[model samples]
Target: MRIFDPHIHMTSRTTDDYAAMAAHGVRALVEPAFWLGQPRTSVGSFVDYFDSLVGWEPFRASQFGIRHHCTIALNPKEANDPRCREVLDILPRYLAKDGVVAVGEVGYDSMTPEEDDVFAAQLELAERFELPVLVHTPHRDKAKGTTRTLEVVRESGLDPSMVVVDHLNELTVGEVADSGCWRGFSIYPDTKMDPDRMVAILTEYGTERVLVNSAADWGKSDPLRTYATGQAMLAAGFSADDVDQVLWRNPVAFYGQSGRLELEGADADEGATFEGNSILRGARAS
Candidate 1:
């Protein structure tokens, strides 16, 4: 089953993870700018991280034949920090890059006033750029947070269809479904929705606007969780087309709204490198 992980942090993963994802049919994925394991100290740190998201990460994914794209934003967790707030100033620069497909991982972390402000600002950025939003709903008080999320999106006047309410479960999916926003489920090892539950959701929801991702990050997670969900769907009697719709086509439809989603096709210069740095040990970009 071909897969497209709509939200994953490939920077925290290894080359072997890319190889495994490619082998499992992940032809493309979006790596959103999120909070790393530790708190970053300054805007400069965010700049470097965003740079790697667009620069090094794409080159890394291409080595394994997976097209890499990213979303640029000041993630909600770091939005609480005054120092990190300056990262917002530089977001558009990264957002304008060809690799950036959305403005994301943007939503309430603590449901704080600061998170609200930052989230609103990023929505403005999404509006200005005409990009889709990959919103990260709060892990705690999700019912309340998701309610507020929809409220804020409606208040911002951003089309709900342009927003993806991610990290959803059975309790939250219905609300997002009714809100006209797309649904996203993060299949993780634990502490998030499981593949069986994801399949159950698809069965009930009928796969219209669902997006399933591994959300593999620095935490204990599995980048192959998306592929595993497809397998589970098949085991549950979901057709291959059903698996493709949830895992691949749905994501393509969402991010493709940016008009910047480019799955790497035949390369005229297969040996291309990032600047002068090569993923190949002995080959040159020429």
Candidate 2:
């Protein structure tokens, strides 16, 4: 089945992962800006990271025939840092970029007042830019975080259909469903919802606005979980169209709100150069 992973962190991944993802039928993906394991000290660090998200990463993914798009934001964890806060000013420039499909990974991390302020401000940015948003609910105290998230989303006055609250499980999906925002599940090998559990949610929810992703990053995450989820859905008697809706159509509908998804021409060009640097090393293979 064809797939579009709506949320993943490709900055921390290698080219091998890209090859594997393409081989497994992942044709497109959205990489939202997020906290790196190492704390970034200044806005400049974020600048470099954001540049790569819009530049190098897409080139790398294209080398594997995967159309890569990204969301730009000062992620929740870093919003608390005084130095990192300046990055928010620079965000408008990136948000105006071509491959930036949304403003995202923007929501509660610690749920600090700092987080609250930043999250709201970014929502305003999303509204002003007329782009969709990818909201990240806290890994801890998720139910509470998600509730607070929907409240702020409501307060922001952005259309519910324009937002996607991600990293959900059975406990939190219902509230997001009722709120009219899209539901996003990150199928992980451990910790978050697995493939089987995701299938059950689809069974109950019937796959209207649901988006399933690998959400893979630098951690112990699996990049092929989206493919795995599709396989599980088939095993559980889901039709091909059902898998297509969850894996492909759902994400396109959500991120397509940006009017910036470039799905065609994803074929790999090994000779491609981003800033005069190709993915190839020293010598050409003869």
Candidate 3:
């Protein structure tokens, strides 16, 4: 089951996770900009993080033969911080770069007034850049968060087809489905949707505009959940074509709207370096 994980956080993962994901048939992924486990104190902190997303992380993923792409945004969780607000200003520079497939992880976190303002600003940036968006619904009060999310998307006047409302469940998927936007589910190990539940969702929704991801981050998340979901689909009698649609084709179709997705197989040149640095630890002996 070839896979393209539409959302994940490799910044917080290890190289072992990359090797495991590649072995499990994960060929490509998109790592959205999101809050670190702790608060980021300055705009410079975000600058470093975003640079790694566009630079170091892709190099790391390539070592394991996984094509890595990313989204650029001031995530909603940090929108309330006056210090981090400057991140929005610097986003345009990153948005113009290669490997930035969308403007993402942008939506309500606390649903605060500050979040509303930042979310709207990023959505406008998406319009200006003509890029796809990855909207992250609130983990708390998700149904209400998703409702307001779709409303904001409508108000932005960006084509709903260019937006993906992520972290949805059975309760919220239907509304996004009807909104003409793509639907995204993050399959987790213990919380949120799991493989079986995702299978059931696919069974009902028919896999047309669905994007399944692990969304694995610096928490108790599993990086291999995308692969697990594909296995579950097969166990539940989904055809190889059906699994491919959800795991590969759907993500390519959604993020492909950016006209920037580089789906080429990962070719790791061990001698290749980013900024005069390599993932290698010691010199090789002949």
Candidate 4:
């Protein structure tokens, strides 16, 4: 089953994870810009981080035969900080860079007024850039957050088709589905929707613009959940084409709006060295 993980944090993941993803049929992914576990102190730090997302992460994923793309944004959690607000100014420059397929992970973290301001600005950025958005709904009070999120998106006047409201669950999926925006579910080991639950959603929703992702990051998340979700769907008697629509086609249709989604995911040359240093187990250092 070919997979395209539409939301994940490869910045916090390792090459071994990339290798495993490729081996398990993950052909492409989008790593949305997000807050680090700790606070970022300055705009320059986000600059450096965005550089790595479009630079180093893509290179690393290529070594393992997976296509890598990313979204650029200030991220919601840090938008409340006065210091990191300067990141909003620098986002356009990175958004123009190749492999930045969307402007994302850019919705309510705490639902502060400040977060609201930044989220609105980034929605405009998505409009200006003609890119799809990956919105992060607040984990707490998610139902309320989701309602407000739909309001914000509707007010932005960006086509709802170009926005993907992510991290949804049974409680919130109905509203997101009804909103004309794409629906996203994060399959996690715990604390989020699991594969079985995802299958249940498919059984209920019937998969039009629904998407599933692992959303694996530095936390205790599994990078293979997208693959596992596909597996569970098959076990639940969903056909291969149905699985294809949810796990692969939906993401392609969403991110493909960028007109920059060059899907050479399985076409990477297999080499295991970076910066003239060998990464292979027994290669002589040259």
Alpha-carbon TM-score of each model against the true structure:
0.92, 0.92, 0.92, 0.92
Query: Where does model 4 exceed 4 Å of error?
Result: 265-286
Task: Tell me each candidate's RMSD, in Å, in order.
Answer: 6.2, 6.1, 6.3, 5.8
Residue 34, model 1: Cα distance from true site in angstroms: 0.3
lDDT of 1 by residue, 14-35 (tens): 9989877876667789999999
> Worst ten-residue run, lDDT, model 2?
277-286
What is the lDDT of every predicted structure here?
0.88, 0.89, 0.89, 0.87
**What C-alpha lDDT does candidate 4 achieve relative to the native structure?**
0.87
Lowest summed lDDT over 10 consecutive residues: which window, candidate 4? 277-286
Prediction-by-prediction clash tally = 0, 0, 0, 0
Off by over 4 Å in 3: 266-286
Residues 139-194, candidate 2, lDDT per residue (tens digit)?
Answer: 99999999999999999999999999999999999999999999999988998999
For residue 286, give model 3's deviation from the true position in Å: 33
- Evaluate residue 33 in candidate 2 and report its C-alpha lDDT on the 0 to 100 scale: 92
Error of 3 at 36 (Å): 0.7
